[model samples]
Target: MKKLLQTIILLFFFSLTSTVSFAQGYKIIGKAIGFADSTKLYLADVTDGSFKPIDSTYIVAGDFRFEGKLKHKVVQTYIHTKNFADRVSLWLENTTVHFSAEKGKFKQALIEGSQTQNLWTELNKAIKSSKDEKEQYVQFIKKNPDSIISAYLLSLFSTSWGNKTIRDLYGNLTPENKTTSYGKNIETYLALSKDIQIGGSFVDISQPDTSGIIRKLSDLKGKVILLDFWGSWCGPCREANPKLVTIYNEFKSKGFEIFGVGAETSKKQWVTALKKDGLQWVNVSDMKGDKNEAALMYNVGQYPTNFLIDKDGVIIARDISIENLRTKLKDML
Candidate 1:
């Protein structure tokens, strides 16, 4: 009887311990004013531009709650209604997060939680009024190298700073921080940025032309290449096509070629613009718009960007004016 009693006691203790451990995971206690009773709310884990539902609950009165655990120290999570048209996003950490919002004022929702969220809030306020917000973010990243907020800030200001500055800031992150999604993205961007900078060899790209025929940039290696990243919907790109056409006419017989990569979403619109603009150059696109592989590979953020590559495939200049490009061509060819 004594042995059976001891075994029962151990089992009870183990059950209690497990329950406590499970309860210690991250918890979000939310209250939405004017929200209808039984309104469905969803919690989604965001990674690699995709959403995976984690847990869900419905508002009983104006209150709802979610409690769960995450494997990582921090993960980007979103909370929204069933349609997901309106949502709130925050970093979910092992802490109690308090959220409050009005029915139609989701953007104005109040999120109070971990140190990282606090820092993010502070930075957002500073960004609105600060004249030198870039420097403010740089300092924050420097001071919070171990924090996930640093990685988030790095992503926001990555394109604003030069490659060397980005590299220096990224190098300050902790080993654990370097393993996060944003950190890995920074590493990849830095490597690609360095390889495509002025004086570096042009990175070869293969994309589909308008008719779905694949074309390789390397096929035009023996000619002076103007690698243009543009879109049919871009006003500046459309305006600049006439100038490019003139340049092409002047240099076509002199071993000069323009490889125009269109960052377009719709194939029909892209084809229409190509014919309308009379861009008689080699045009190609993967029809992925902003997420185009060629655009991402070259780190082309702004529209109407061009890189002038020599016959040997080395980038000579980037984003030069038409007159400057004409002068350079006269000098080279």
Candidate 2:
């Protein structure tokens, strides 16, 4: 009786743990990649934040099926194949995902979900409006004196557009124009006001590793840190990895270190890329794209960007080249 009771208790505990694990969500299918003979299906947990991959299965004859609990939220589904534009779907509940394309050429895209269509429509409109607002602000700044609106508009352009065009325009503004309210607003926007760049000075000292081990930036105060933002599947970023590795090896012994922050949603992909690229450095990823705290804090509008911080945690460079990075590091070291 005692042994049977213990067995039941163990099973109950196991069931509870499994339920909790599935709390984030479940999926029947995920990313499908590779050619016919080499095809494979990926299963992912939706709520893991970093979109860490959970499991994988092989597909045969262009058909695949797998089962897992569904979590509530929108998730991305990609079908990757060579010689063809990868098929993508924004999957939600109560719908079997389907794909169709023209003969011999699978590069075409077709989505069947009404909800997904609606979402994309709204997104496109927002993008158009944002672009229009940017243009209006530029012309408005040229003629008007500085005001809070002009300052805010400049911030919007830099943070949203993520280009050099507006910054260049601001620089070319006449000295007489600089004296206007518009010029002052632009200047204030470029320089971080006390309240705006909150906690920009304080490095996150209490962030825990994947293992829940707490580590702080100040703990490695003497090291030159390269805060890298990248993604596993990004081809350009992967191209840059080899160069970064070379630099890291050269300067690692000279008080230099790298802290890579990936935007990959899958732990499996993240780990695979890390090993494949020979990235022997500390790394983390929230897997949430724009929802990442660091990305929001730093106003990262694009991938493959980085900040070089000195030993004292002061940002020394932004969006620079490998040659420039090497030169800067040599000076610091």
Candidate 3:
């Protein structure tokens, strides 16, 4: 009995020591099953439509830890496993967060220790349980006008909700909420979305190719040009490259062309990715990441976005799925 009592006491102290509070930064203590030791996991900042992996760690004995100081006050992030085979979103701040899950079940993990995450989880649960998700979402925003989560949600749906709805939601948000990066993106989307409507005249862009020669959108005037916006850091973009290649190859002989605009922060990374992905098409960028002039003109908040321009340079389709694109090409080509 005494030995058992001593063991329990040791565990109690160990638990206390494991989660010591820090003056600044965050600590994530995690455990998982069904993963080998040394399996790498990545932490990425997913805030404001950006996908930047800031850190990574390898699991050891089903356990891992990540703690670091933020350059600024960031509120949200993502944990990616197996090069994004699975992903789980979390709120990040100066606190200790606990995570545990079975391998391949990261999407179901509870990111505990963040108030914002708590609210996010609660709202998601309510939305999932409710039949009228849109109604619930609207009501939540109306009630929580002061919450940053509401601004985040409004920004997320700004594309689907249209400009008027985004403006209404944005107006309802508190001043503090309106100052976030999400809010600014919402404003930008509202402004830029007006000119880039379906069936509208395609916007013209000019940027330097990997060889430093300028390329213009007008160059592909008579071809079915796909203006693809992607990034070197985007896992989905990299994964989709092979399929893109197949599509390009199948349609290139029939007056189809892919004009890829890489949302790259570094020229080296962009060139390397181009080589690795074997994107055998005209790719261009300003090496300014998302701030590329073309990216801004199109309001490209996320990667893997594309515009489909017909022979006359009219944007006939936007963000169509690969299967739909194939079908469309079959008819048009």
What C-alpha lDDT do the candidate models reach, one value each? 0.85, 0.58, 0.83
Which candidate tops lDDT?
1
The sequence of per-residue lDDT tens digits that candidate 1 reaches over residues 1-333 is 999999999999999998887657799999988878999999998755457899999998899999988888788888888987569887788789999998877877899986677777788888887899787888889988998888866654555465678789999999988888878767766765534689989998999898788999999999999999999999999999999999999998999999999988789999999999999888999876755677767877788899999999999999988899999999889
Clashes of 3: 0
Model 2 error, position 7 (Å) = 64
Instruction: Identify the superior model by lDDT, candidate 2 or candidate 3.
Output: 3
Q: Which has the greatest TM-score? A: 1
lDDT of 3 by residue, 1-333 (tens): 999999999999887776554346788999877899899999898885566887999999999899987664546788888568878888787777898878889889867887777878888999999999988888889998877788888877776676777788789998878888877877777666655777788888899998999999888899998989999999988988898899999999999999999888788889999998999999999886765667767766678898899998889987877888888899999
lDDT of 2 by residue, 1-333 (tens): 999999999999999998776463433432233446446545443322234464556666555555444443344444333322443333443344444433334344344443543444344455567857555566655653333233334544554543355466676565665554444544644552222232245345234444445555567666888878788877888999999999999999999998877775567787889989999977777665433455544656577888777787777777778989999989989
Clash count, one per candidate? 0, 11, 0
